[model samples]
Target chain A: MKRAELIFQSIALITLAVAFILFWNFGKGVSFAENGLPSGPTVTDSYVVLQENLNRMIPILLGSILLSVAIAFYLEEYLARTGWKYQIIARQIIILASIPSLLYGLLGLYFFVFQSKKGSFFIHALTVVLLVMPRTIQSTQMAIRSVDISIREAAFALGAKRWRVIIDHVFPHAFSVIMSGIFTVISRALAIAALIIVVYVWTKHTLQSGDTFYIPGSAIVLLLSSLLSSVLSSFLEAKTNWD
Target chain B: MQSQKTDPILHIHDLNVWYGKSQILKNLTFDVLPRQVTAFIGPSNSGKTTLVRCLNRLNDLNVNFRYTGKILYKDENLYAPQLKAAKIAQQIGMVFQKPIPFRKSIYENVAYSARLRGIKQSDQLDTIVEESLRKAQLWDEVYKHLHTSSDALSNGQQQRLCIARALAGDPEILIFDEPCEQLDAAETPKLEAIVQNLKSHYTLIFVTNKRRQAARVSDVAGFLYNGELVEFGQTEQIFTNPIDKRTENYVTGRL
Candidate 1:
């Protein structure tokens, strides 16, 4: 292998080792007494409530992904051109991103959830969508910007109009980067959904795990699974493209 | 010098280009005739590349980069504020010193513009790609593997692919900015041949520092020094019997 490659590998391995050490020694810190373990699972009314939360969480995850993809497409294609509209759109995106996720949930509650008078599941999902949309827009914009200017110019000089340049040149060149950003937003939204549920949980009273096995920790498990899946999928996808 | 009798196809009159408060090109004036290769030669920081970019309005990409002058393409003024840079770019394509191929298949690179012009039929796109590659002298090597990624090609091939991408638009004028600077010595002459062959169909404007290579390819030559046009005339006259002292010094390596 090249010396540079070897050095990079060594650095990555060392960083991973350090991270593992920190996680094992400093991160996990729960202790148990008497039985020398945590409390065993309980069969109580809360199990059904957790199931309901899981059910509500699943749709929120899906909605976040769908919403992020839509926002990504718009930022990558429509808002990238040079004009007053581009500047205004970019500024609006920045302002939107700066708003906290809880604020977005509040806004969604006012707009979609409260007005529609639907179940908490739809409200939670819509809130998650609003929370994740701005991040996706920003990531997609960055990915599009990273495309080489020469490639875009070359396409335009050849006869490509504005839309053609984005679809044929900019989009293809930025596909991997944009997909990775989408994955990042999906993971982030999954984590945020758990927090949103905690905030709005008082109103719903019980969590809804969709037509599946229900447990007290289902909400936490669902959040963990979604986060894990997005991260793993992004890694595999990036690895496949790297070759 | 052919008695200076022929009417130039493209002319730059008193071109003064500035980047915000800093001036880059100073009162530049020159003319290029049709079906001829004109080379701009100068040392680094001499505004050779800037002058060529100004011709295509690419210099305007920088918000602060402004200019005071008129660039005439077929005697039509290009700097008319109302004219879109994209339209000007369609009329005059550019190839940079570095080979920049979009991370896509060779066929896609060639067909991108055709598709943009609303040609969706596969057969029409295939013909255009083939013709463009043939013009760029890249078809034989890339014919079978046109679907392969363009970055997989050799550096020289990638450079030719960029040229093919430029040609696919069928522009009237072509600008090359030190196109062979990144290539090895062995690849220089092949690039020169491509430039020479292209001059037959398009008005070619090139920027180069290699004196012999400039002499080998250009019909007319302009020497720029310190952001000013030092001399402009036929290639042979500028190389062999330059009138200006600065031009003579530049040609003889005395400067």
Candidate 2:
């Protein structure tokens, strides 16, 4: 690794760790009980919060990855051949990818929460899916495009049709790069989604009461997950780079 | 028709090719006889590659590529809307200047082309793979390590493997676009021998910038200069006799 990347990685790790530790111990010694047991009014159970978040997140992650890959494949392999429309659509997707996650949350809130009166869980999960998909689609498209043209030519020269070239040659050759792209985008999206959720819950809790404090366990899980995922993504990108 | 067997396998007429507005090959005409090596020789940027690419319609992959040509393979229009590039490619195999082996086991590398043509039974695949490798003159070196990755092979062996891969598809016409350009001195002879041997069964179109290589391998030879066919005839005549001044200058290394 370059010295610059190493420095940046170290700094990021230290910052996240320090922030997490400070948050974990924020209200620990703020008050003392009559029995001398330090206790601030505790909020909701951490385990329940963790479980509920998992119940929402897993489905969204899987669904978003599948949906993004499909959209990306259609855009690249099929739509890309259609000329001007593909160029316009590709540019629009890039713009969508750069849009803030907060906008997606508000859109989901309007559609699923207000219009249909669905549960917050449905709206929340959908919001995260929408938030993650654009970036994932972009990354997937890049991965597919990065496949060596010669490989495709070789397959075509052997009488493989466009679909066969994609299925038999292109996909297998681009698999590791595509996987790395997926992991990297998912990691970033997970961090963003977790940040939004934590802030949202904390704001609601603070407005409702002054004494009680809550730290959602989902925050820690997501932070750890995003860390792990980012590391895995880096490893995959570096190690499997055939070039 | 038995008489058709004696006919020119490929007949290219008034072929003009361009990438965007810039012309590459201009008004090129040629006939490649069956069961013979017809070589196209020219210096770089003389439209040699473009002309060879036109044979199997491989240039269609380029969005900017356009051509005015009649390429007849077995008297049928090659550029006909009804004919798919894949189907055209099946009958016409191409080997590039650089050898590109798929990241696959040596067995799979040869078998892949067969599998694409829907040959599913393992025994049939095995036979085709063996036959192709033999024809490529690589069977002796690689037969024991057929399951190993093709990446393990040397550059020359990889080139031969590419030939085997092309052969596995059972193409009626094989196009070698500067096939020996990347091969070393030791490997070039082997490739030349394979081309010589292949001509008895498959019609061969060999393209090269190497004048002597063309002279050594080709039965009929075409000299391309500035997107035009300068001279074309039997190899000996093109090499020795005075025809086009450009052809003489090229073969004699005065160009």
Candidate 3:
């Protein structure tokens, strides 16, 4: 690899390791009472709270996965292949990826939570989608870009149209790489959803009493599901060939 | 020189290609007659591959690539803006230097092109897969494992499978970009024979640095030097009595 790429990769690794260490620390000293829940919470009590949070998280997880896949398919296969729209969408994804998650949480609270008034689960799900969409689109675009030009040429030369070539030739070739990106986004979405819900729960509890503290429960379930889903997705993705 | 009355399947007139600001091919004109093997012989980076890519508009895929050329297929102006790349490719298929089968079943690899053209019937697809594999001379070795993953095939089989995929499209012209470059010396002749037999129906355009391979397969040969067509004629004339000193030196390995 080039020296510049090597340096960039090293910095990225160090940053990731530091972030993981911090996140682990946050999980270790986590307390439900800080967010206004009743004190003296046991493991079983935490499990019951976690089960309630899972009910909200399950749909958010499924929605994030489905939406990410759909957005990836559109961007990689359809939008990226077209003229003008490709550049526009690409720039939009970059801008979205650069935005902070706190901003997305605020937007979700204002728009999806207050305007729609569909309760916390739906707002949290929408927030998760917004948080993950940009990275998912970007990574999937990179995956599609990494595909060999010759493969697409061969397919086109054989008379496959833009849609047909992507569906038959490009998608199968880039599926594993795109799946990896989707899994990355899924894991990110899981963590970010927990953070957003914690922030939302805290803010709502400060406004009034009887507001349930959903953090410890949401964090536990998010951790477990992120690990489980990532492992499952990786297994399915590993069975396929990327080259 | 002998001139046959058969209409050329593909005709290039004043073809020129450019990569960004740098011009590559300049005023290249040639004709590939139907049912004949035409070889493009040149040194490395001489634009032989670029020329063949223009046949099916594959060069258009490059972001910096541009060209001013008239490529005619069966007397139809293929370079016209109205003609789509996919339509042009349906008429002219390309096989790259390396075999690239999809990460799918062997049967699906052969059936892919046909399916792209809307041949969804299982029986029709089966017939096409069988016929294409037979034509590529790969049927006997892979018939039993049609449903197996294509990656399971050996290198030679994968290369032949690429040929079968091209043939499945039923293109009138088939362009091979150094098809045997990756094959071992012993395996080269097997693919050569397949190309030799393929000339009866498909107009073959092969790009190769190997002079002997060109002489062995092509009826007409074009010698390219630094993106220029130095000499072009019957393979016998170009190989035995090349008029240009560059061509002579190139053929004799003196350059």
Candidate 4:
């Protein structure tokens, strides 16, 4: 395999392993038994935690992915145009990509948990949304940057407008790369979502349920969903969009 | 298609281009005659590419690209606010040094521009595709596989496909920017024959650094050096007995 593919798969595998561990820890923490299990009702207890974790993270993950892609599209176009403003916007994207997700958790703690009602879904989801955007923007930038000048010139020489050239030629070619980036961001979202949920649960002192061990199954779901979405989006885009 | 003598196909007057503060073209003035091959020959970095881009407003894609001049096509200033770049490009088709097939079928590659103008009927599109491919001298090779991906063709075939794509648009003028740069020894002659046959119907511009190619293909040639037009006249005169000392020096390999 190529080096880039190797690295992509390696990072994906490592993250999947880490996600599994995080979920397992959550499962153990929430269990009513001595060893990450319920005393008399294992199935019921596991189901409840599963439901709770799904309810908390799924909406945030899906919503943020959509929002991030939208923002990335606009930002990519802005950066693709020839202007001095590109450097400034690009620097901002760099700062955003480098920012730690933990900072978002801290912000979520103070603003979403403390300022507003404690442990609200909207606030937590919003925090994850904010976190997902930067990398998505960066991914979009990289994809747009990869667009060959010859492809664009061919379209332009044939009398395509700036928007038409982007929508027709630029976007389809970038779609595969952008979809991979989105998957990476989605996986990152799963990690961030897990981190935020822990912070929220610990602060709220909800120790009655076996919700702590729910992270493993959730991570598996995230990994599968990431793969599924990547394949689906790319297949659909390549089919419908490209000439 | 042209009837007026005073109205040349294209007129360039005092064109200057700058990329971020560095000037690339300087005070260039020239006229492109109708139904003739006009060659622009210059050493690398002499702004040959930049000059052709000005004709169809392709340089507008450059972020820091700024220019001062007027390029009049068919007596209309191409830079006029009322005129869109798309409108200019529709009439002026360009083929790049590298042939780029749109990752589509051979037929679709030729029909791309026609479809942009809303030509949807497959029959009509087929006719356009066949005519264009015949004109580019590519029909005999790839006619059986028009439905297959264009990427499968050889570099020479791809260049011809690009010419067919340009021709499909029904453009009045066709500009070739070093179309032979990527072709092999055998493929160059294939393209040369097509170009030689094309000037009877279209105002063609050939931008190349090769003096031999210009002498073989162009009716008239312009030599640009350091962003300035050194000489512009009949290809025979410019190649055999150039009046300008710089042109003579550059042609004879002294400079």
Candidate 5:
């Protein structure tokens, strides 16, 4: 909430908005108009193809991302519990999260595509899932850890069951933390898609690739989401009093 | 508040607790009477925290925490295997030494427990929130800001908000684990006043390191030393005529 930070964020946001306007204008400004009658070879238009790819590809991408989040909830519970056995799994998750995403993309290509000979779209979605799941799990762990212990204890002492305590007390307190980390991981996952798009498009056997346009759209999406999430987490963190 | 000599609601029968290999509470026995404030006074490392946590089985959350003996709540053995901590907690609510209001609105903070208890009517929840806040002596300060995040309140107010949250559940007993320890001198009296007023409706148990606070607030006082209960009796008698040497030493400031 500092003035300098606020100014920086505002400037970044404005640049993003201008970038979005430029993309939208690109979609509509293709025709050369004379006497208000437009004429051109509209053969360069790939917007329909782009929409087709998005409609087909987006669902798989979102499904994998949601799967990661679902797994993260269970993983967070394991991380929160006490025991050396759980600690071993926690250490493994930490190690997996620390490994680079590029390596994961290669592993996905090997395991989900080359080894199994699956379709390109399915393999790509699988690859992205592998790339993002570890980071999501790591973020979920941190979110749960950040919740104050006293709040959970207070709920337990009120006769709230374990799930009740988590739903009512721990999860609400940790919601911002969870959302921020999940959003960051999603952005990173989208960025990974952008990074691997070259290989992804090549593998799909499509020279009429419309993904070139998807890159800029996703970049804007990534930037905005990460920014929004950071703002949300910081707002929750800064709240100290109401009266 | 009930008389200090009333039949016990919670009977602790030689309870012992250990954190892994290290012992925390050693052969502790006591009884908590209904609607009366029972204060536990002890120096550092005397297991005051561990003792209170045992009442609601909050200590069970600690994987290393292990205990023996029996705690009877209304002739039901609280330490029995079939008894879950969450179930025991329905009758025992706690306010910690530090204020821990959730990142929520004032009404939401108090209404949280009521919702968990399966009260779905908005009107009913509103009434419970108002009544709980009123009982905690915080409604007048917070009524106008019911929808605002509790973080805006001062430390004293935040602690009171916690009390209101606990009260919303209508638990039979309310435990104070050194509620004013984290508070400053200016905020202490406000918390003490709330604690004093709370004894009329709920069974109040206090764990404090402050000698004067124990004498001022408690109907009965128990002295703990080195993980053992040394003496327990009427607060006035415990202060004026302690039976054991360790109790005398602790109360008279000789140790």
Candidate 6:
């Protein structure tokens, strides 16, 4: 590994270890005295909160990745190749990505929760997908575009079809860059619970005051996942390096 | 070889190519004889690359690219509405100015073309890979490191590996678009030798600006000046005898 990469891994490891320790010691229940000493164990659904967050976050993260990557591929490979105005589309995506997250929350609340009348879980998850997709699409498009055009031409000259060029050659060349972009999106998706609060409010399931472990528990989970994603993307980037 | 030379493998007739209203190649025509090296020599941006790319339809990827031409391969229309680029590419392969080995192992880089044609048996792939490498004149050096990444190879070896990759597809005709442009003096002769050796098996179209390289390698030579085919004939005649003033000037290094 390079020196910078080793340093980055070390910092990430230290941060994760500290976060884990902090969560383990104080993330069980709300127990405190006037002097801030541990009084006693209290009633807190810490495990339930953790489970609920995972159940909500995983699918949305996966959905965002799948949907955005597909959209980005179509835009770059097909539409862009057919002479579409990609710069305008990319600019529009950047504008959408920069819009406030709460606006997406409200949009989701009005559409999925109000018009469709779906369950809160589905609504919230889909809303998070909507919130994170713009940035992911932008980044994914950049990754796909960053692939060397010569490689694609070389593949085409080898009797491979357009789809084959994309699937077998282009995707592998761009996979590491794509994963790095997706990892950034994943981190964004995990921290987007604040957006879910809008739908949670309407669904009559809001964060309780005494459930103190929920916030810290979610934070540690986010940290750990981000670190894991970093490592995985780095490994993939190394594995796929051709030069 | 004499039997193969009886008929031209590729016939480009009255070809004109344009990209977004800017004409690149204008009214160009030529015949590429089978199992021989036909070199197109020209200055930069004279549409030499464009003409080569038109053979396998690689220019189709450009959205604004437009062309009016009839490219006949073995008496069949290459630009027929039903003939897909993939199908043309299978019979007519291309190597670019820069060597672009796929981001794969040396073995996989060569085998990838075969795998695309659904050659799934490992033993078959190994045999094809070895044969291609040997044909590219690279098997002796790289046979031991078949599974290693192609990144470890020198630029010359990488270019040869690309040749092996193209040959693995069993193309009858191979296009070399400035294959020696990126190679050093030491490496150029090696590639030149490979091209000379390959003429017995595959129809070769070589594009280069180096006049002597063209003189040394081509069986037939065509000079392009501003996308026009100034001359096309035997290499020795084109080099030494009377022809178009432009062709004479180009060959003698005056223009």
> What's each prediction's TM-score?
0.72, 0.82, 0.77, 0.82, 0.79, 0.83
For model 3, the DockQ equals 0.50
The residue-level lDDT of candidate 6 at B15 comes to: 94
Stretches > 4 Å off in candidate 1: A1-126, A198-243, B1-6, B81-83, B117-124
| Candidate number with the higher lDDT (1 or 6) | 6
Instruction: Tell me the lDDT of model 3 at B48.
Output: 93
**lDDT per model vs. reference:** 0.75, 0.82, 0.79, 0.80, 0.76, 0.82
lDDT of 2 by residue, B139-245 (tens): 99999999999999999999999999999999999999998898889999999999999988999999999999999999899999999999888898999994999
The sequence of per-residue lDDT tens digits that candidate 4 reaches over residues B167-244 is: 998899999999998889999998989999998889999999887898899988999999999898889899999999
Best-to-worst order by DockQ is 6, 2, 4, 3, 5, 1
Best by DockQ: 6
| DockQ for every prediction shown | 0.31, 0.58, 0.50, 0.56, 0.49, 0.60
The top-ranked prediction according to TM-score is 6
Candidate 3: residue B77 lDDT (0-100): 87
Worst 10 residues of 4 chain A by lDDT: A38-47
Error of 6 at B49 (Å): 0.3
Considering the two chains of model 5, state its CAPRI-style docking category.
acceptable
The interface RMSD values of the models, given in order, are 2.7, 1.1, 1.9, 1.3, 1.9, 1.0
Docking class of 4: medium
CA shift at B61, candidate 6, in angstroms? 1.0
Question: What is candidate 1's lDDT per residue for B85-161, written digit by digit as tens?
Answer: 77788778888988988777999987866665667999988899999899888999989999999978999999889
How well does candidate 6 match the true structure in TM-score terms? 0.83
Question: In model 6, where do residues sit more than 4 Å from their true spots?
Answer: A1-4, A31-53, A81-92, A106-122, A194-243, B1-5
Q: How many residue pairs clash in each candidate?
A: 10, 0, 0, 9, 7, 0
Cα displacement (angstroms), candidate 6, residue A143, comes to: 0.5
Q: For residues A1-243, could you state the per-residue lDDT of candidate 4 as single tens digits?
A: 699999998999999899867866665444434556433333235445446767776777777677766666666664544345654665565555555665555566556655675467777677776678778877877887799978999999998887888888998999999899988887776666555555454534554454344434454565455546555654564467434
Give the Å shift of residue B114 in candidate 1.
Answer: 3.7
